[model samples]
Target: MTLALPPLVDHHCHGVLRRSPDADTFTSHLTESDAPAAPGTSFFDTQLGFAVRRWCPPLLGLDPHCPPERYLERRRELGADEATRRLLRASGTGTYLVDTGLPGDLTGPAELAELGGGEAHAIVRLESLAERTADASHGPEAFVEVLDHAVAAATRTAAGFKSIAAYRYGLGLDPEPPTAAEVHAAAARWLDGRTPGERLTDPVLLRHLLWSAVRTGLPLQLHTGFGDPDLRLDRCDPLLLTDFVRAVAPYGCPLVLLHGYPYHRHAAYLANVFTHVYADVGLALSHTGARAEAVLAEALELTPFGKLLYSSDAFGLPELYVVGARVFEEALTRLLDAWTASGAWSGPDGERVAHLLAAGNARRLYGLGPDPS
Candidate 1:
């Protein structure tokens, strides 16, 4: 029998766009590359593209595998509100822990929760908070105090904190918390180089923000593995974080490694050895599409079931929510079914593991109650 998972808890994700994107914009969201597709080639040819073509049409009252043009046309016809509502509801997500770091005209957590028929919580971005408060403060010492205040205020309501240090300066940062004088000096340099809306990339500042968040005793999510042009893929490996992980172990702060792709096995190994570390295959699964089974298998190879969590990492488009959910449910069900059939795991054990990965682990870590729905 096919094992159906319970409603999912997306422990890491972003909100949907506020407006319906034109066809080109929609296509851009499919892949991680910032550049447009090469001449004469459509983004529709990718695994994620084909998965959307095959899986999303039925939600819009069309047959599966319909042409991309037809799908986009149907999307435009229904408009953004209708499309988002339909797709998010269909995804069967019971909760969303949204990362509010990326700047975009997207819904906030409460709006997403209402639209998805679930609950939502915020994941404060450490860099964004620093940037927002930077211009307001004149001196580096004041900047440090302002950022600390901001983080403390955010921790009161936010479910967790996220850092894109991997994207900004790679994961090879010195794990030791910087001295006050070092942070003040780094802040002065960052302030001198500041352009309006520039991101916080100074390594010392990044380390300071991470240590500040760790002190909150809240879960800290770090972007790892593959991402856009902003990061060096080779430098984004979770293995590079081994020293930092070891450094933060005493605080009992949970470190969630997000979207570890080619390095997923490495992330799983960290989660295996480090009692405070957790890992997920979020962006990798949606982009890998039909190959999600292999990625999920690698993620599961060494990680304990209780250490795995679910996330779509879905951004601009709601179709991604549907696609991520479908592929995950399909891939996980097949793996568990095969294991149970082979007698490698009992049926009851398979069911329990499925639930753990789907929602239980997230609930336990975040201190969330049962979904109201």
Candidate 2:
């Protein structure tokens, strides 16, 4: 019995490449690792690499699990636009909540929506907004005024907000909203020594950006668990965010923890305990491939159905979207099927819960409308 999930509301993702990528560039997007694969082992030797070769080829007019070289050759032949179109359309995602934070030669929300044959909404990255604000404002005081106004303005259009505080100053930082004095001093110090286009990394300023977004009452997505080398994995655990999660609870802002792999269970535990907390195995599921079922099982252990949302976290590659969706749906179907077969869950309950994970949870959390047809 298939799960027959609804079209997904991909609640957290990023845009695909704007131009055709060379082999190395394309493979780079497949893993969280920033470095190239070891000389003998290809990035294609990984689970995500295998998953893409398996799931994406059939969509691109080839047999499943074709050689990586063949897949790239065919992709080049089809061209980026055509390849991206075929893959995104086959993904079965109806709506995209795109993070417009990462800098690259990538599509914007509107272009991605059109290419994927779905509607798209923006999830403004708070740090990006603050950094841009800092770039324009000379004084600490003016920076505060400008950033506050920017956050308020973003709330009117963006579906949510995302913060990479985990990448900057670990999630272990003091969670309480920083006082204005601290914010001003931090801003002054940062701007004084900052080079052009320097990222926002100060702990105090990160707290301020977070609090400002919280004040907007938008659902805030926080990056947790695995990422590039910039992150300290020891510090990326969601448990480290307990104080901040608890502090943000009163403001009624939904905290969506993204890419919680090794820590997905902890994230689920947070969702179970906190009314405003939500979690997704976005980047994890895509990267883990065949092992996504184990990840999903762990995520489901403590999370309520309504608190688990669907997301691809696919960045710079449409194939990631294809593999992400396929792995998630397959993993979820197998999990629910086994449970229902064992009489642990009723058939109707299993169906309903699958739908919740696919789209319902995200719709409610983000206050989105019905999924696209």
Candidate 3:
């Protein structure tokens, strides 16, 4: 009773590493922690690690559930370029919206699209743009002018905008857009003490960045819930976004909350009530691995059929592309099949909903579909 889905649209992901990873780097992809796993326990024993072993090895010419050493050895044998190409091409993903904001010598949007044999679009990260623009300004006024110009230009070409405010200032910041005077004050203070490559965590600037994206009439993606050590899970709750969601609902801008894990249901509740809110358990799905079925079932609890979208939120390792897609396919099949078999949902309707989650909703959000090629 497996439900077949269309080629996925990976709405959120990043470029694979340009260089081949060593054993530690390969294992690092198995978890969200910035630090290594506890001394005795290995990240390789986790669900993600096992999923990778099962899904990725065959793509590299090894059997399923291959040993880590054999997997790495085979990966190196094929070389990074060939390995990445094979993995992404085998993913069966129709479109990729890659976030290039992270620091890395990774492939760009064009390269990613080229490699995957599909359309690729960029998603601008607000904080990264602001920090770079701030480094070039002399005062708050100049900072505002420069940043405004930069963001406007970037927005014109980008399919959407993204924010990591949860990782920076948390989701509990003031929901209102800053006034001109307040913007000047915050910028002045931040600039006065700004250091080279200093991170932007000021609540004012983060909110300002979000509001700026809102003004662009583009879909806005916000990093919410589980992530690396930089985030406080308690502070990343989607419920904290109530004020912000209410303020922006009237603007008709799509507010997409990415990677809602432990609070996925909370995010779904927001999407259920707000016309403009949407939720995806992307990174959470890939990281959860074997347990992604229960996670996906929960994400579907309160979200409307139209407001839920799909993404991998996969980064760094190219193998994640394969693992993410496999896990998603399996999880959706198991959930939807059971529902249909029990007469809870019609088979036809279930198939349609599966398509919507696979790629239809994403196409509507980012204005993408029907490959020109």
lDDT (0-100) at residue 206 of candidate 1? 99
Candidate ordering by TM-score (highest first): 2, 1, 3
lDDT of each residue in 118-220, candidate 3, tens digit only: 7789999999999889878888899899999988999768999999999998999899999988888888888887896898988888888999999898999
Worst 10 residues of 1 by lDDT: 364-373
* Tens-place lDDT digits, model 2, residues 127-204: 988888888997889999998889999988999999999999889989899998999999999999787789988999
State in Å the error of residue 11, model 3: 0.5
The full ranking of all candidates by lDDT, starting with the best, is 1, 2, 3
Q: For candidate 2, which ten residues in a row score worst on lDDT?
A: 364-373
Candidate 2 local Cα displacement, residue 7, angstroms: 1.3
- lDDT of candidate 2? 0.91
lDDT score, candidate 3: 0.89
For each candidate, give its TM-score against the true structure.
Answer: 0.98, 0.99, 0.98
What's the C-alpha lDDT at position 359 in model 1?
A: 92
Please, what is the whole-model Cα lDDT of each candidate in the order they appear? 0.92, 0.91, 0.89
| Tens-digit per-residue lDDT, 1-373, candidate 1 | 4666778999999999989899999999999999999999988899999989888899999989998888999998999999999999999998999999888899999999999998899999999999989968777889899899999999889999999999999999998999999999999999986876888889999999999999999999999998999899999999999999999999999999999998999999999999999999989999999999989999999999999999999999988888888899888988988888899999999889988998999999998976455
* lDDT, candidate 1, at 41: 97
Report the C-alpha displacement of residue 161, candidate 3, in angstroms.
0.5
Clashes of 3: 0
